[model samples]
Target: MALCEAEKTFVLHGVEENFRIDGREREDYRPMELETDIVSHAFGSARLRLANTDVLVAVKIEVDTPFPERPFEGKLEFFVDCSANATPDFEGRGGEGVAIEISNTLSAAYSSPNVFDLKKLCILKGKKCWKVYVDILLLECGGNLFDAVSLAVKAALWNTQVPLVKQIDIDGNNVEIKVSEELYDCRKLDVEKAPILVTVCKIGEHCIVDPNVAEEQCSVGSVVVAVSEDKFSTILQTGTGSLHMSTLVDCLQLGIKVAQRLDAALWDTLTLECYTCSTTEDESDTTCLDNPSGVVGGVTDCDKKYCIIVRVDYKDPRGKLASILRSCVDKPTYTNDVIEDETHRVYYRSCRTAKCNGGSGRSDSTSDDNGSLGDKSTIYCPGIGDGAVAVTVSFSILLFAYAFVRYVR
Candidate 1:
């Protein structure tokens, strides 16, 4: 739908006020949530959500003959899929145009050898080399897809786990590669110098960062700037509007500054292995939402139930009451309950619930006075079998819930 004159005027006025419709300054960005190592089946994977925009990236490695001219280097290919989930207009081949545009831009950004050293991926000169395929799935489009996709792709590569090459045997015209049998004996991709793209949207001669859907619709033009360790790697103009040389240079400078900050923040989050979740660093699993089997505590378990709990320490009465209830049960199955008291207001829901009958007995409450449930928390199950399988299954659910509530918040 087209925006009315008054709405447009309001947006323009807001921009003049140095604040956009989303209550953010022109240079401010929407809240971004990132998770790496999400797709286990792939070599490396990451999921990035910037406000309403959701992007998933996976990297797959394959052996292939190197190009005759570039025999010493490997190859990197980008493929983007604009899923129907992003928008009904993207159903089937409808999103192909946008997908191609995004993929092409990514390819251009990574084409420079300095941005990504293809030589590091080569298994052998001229004959065989590792081909890295970066596949991006767009789940939702809230705007600023280019920036989000670029960040996801970089993060996925950072989390990529490459198998260790034990030996390479060449016989006649055939080449054979031996991979390490030990799972942990893998090589991690070097991504310390990965590039991050930032989109600068020009609205009424003013530039902005991380524009939302509404803002994108109003912007006349945009410039995508890719920066690696504060160096400008690539710059591409987008949209139909024309930009003067000086304005384009100004936008590029701003984009580089923003990208440097973004890259640092992303690296910090990626390296953070500790979380409030119940699972230890060694036990945590990573899973993506697009997979048929839901990712539970980062692990792919299609048949199991998973829940995410957010704790609010606010002094609102409603929040305090909900926290109290969550603390009482090992797993809070009552999602509809909204408790209000004099202290705080809270919103909590049951992500998943499974009914299992076990031994008939009431178990002691394992929660604390502060409404915190520990990792060893348990619930009474009636008619549950005494076998190890039953016990393991039951405990896994509790552990999943505990970890979900702890980390997802």
Candidate 2:
């Protein structure tokens, strides 16, 4: 449902209070998960899941004749595909409109020679040049698709492996090139200058970053700024409403500031050891599997520890699973029953068994005597059975004896 004027005003007030609809502050970004080199066939590939939005980018290189006008320059093309998985609305050519718009904007952003060093890809001037095809697949579009796509593209380019050129031979009307076959002999793209797009959505008197679909609908206008090294690579105004010149300028300044920081973080991640491609194919295939936590190697001692610190914000329901796992570590044996309250709140009542064998550290199992209920829901360990009940009864007797002694004293 679209937000009304009053609802939009409330959201604006929330932003003004430094709290967003999703409880994030103005400068805070949603949780993002990034994975690179997942596609085996592509020269470079990355998948980024920002909240609910999912974007996958793959880079493919093909040798082709350069344009006559710009013989020494290679080519970079952008293609965006809106997958059916994103939404039912985008099932059959439904997403083409947005796809074309995004692809066009990206092409324009990278068209400048300064943005990307296309000349370095030239093999033999006008005769032969490398054409890079950047294919973006939109798996989902909860919101902030543009920013997610841009980030994924930059990361994929950073992960790209370009074959080392050995020699180029030109015959009459034909040319041949030799690429080094050594596994370690490969070149990585210099993505230090890659652009990152930031979307500024203006809702009422406030501007927000990484707006969800509902927030986007509430926004009257938005500006997409692609910044590379504090420079404006592309500035695109989106949405139906108009913006004041003063507001637009302010948005541009904020966009540049955010992009610079984002770029720095991206570079830091890319330079880490985990981002580097493995020299051996077998090792490369196992890279992601080996590092389940996605900790990139070669990080400084301080940075390594920081990377391992998993922060769970209790306010987010998604964090409940982690909280539950942490609570179960010290208990030797535990049981839980799901109960629903009158207010419809559902939670678990967990019970832990007392120590058995007089603290001798022996493993014991437990049994339930609740007939059908016990049979359906109770969990018992091997060789425990009635032993746990006996142990509990003995412990109770000891506690009563201690209480009697204290009373007599």
Best by TM-score: 1
For model 2, residues 53-160, the per-residue Cα lDDT tens digits are 889899999988999999998888999999889977798999999999899888877776678788988889889888889999999888988888998899888778
Worst 10 residues of 2 by lDDT: 301-310
Clashing pairs in 2: none
| TM-score to native of every candidate shown | 0.67, 0.66
lDDT against the true structure, each candidate: 0.66, 0.63
Error of 1 at 62 (Å): 1.1
Expressed as tens digits, the lDDT of each residue in 217-271 for candidate 1 is: 7778899988887688778888888898888988998898777777756654454
lDDT of 1 at 33: 78
Badly placed stretches (over 4 Å) of model 1 are: 273-409
What lDDT is reached at residue 267 by model 2? 52
Candidate 1, run of 10 with poorest lDDT: 355-364
Q: What local lDDT does model 1 show for residue 110? A: 81
Query: Which portions of model 2 show Cα errors greater than 4 Å?
Result: 4-7, 273-409
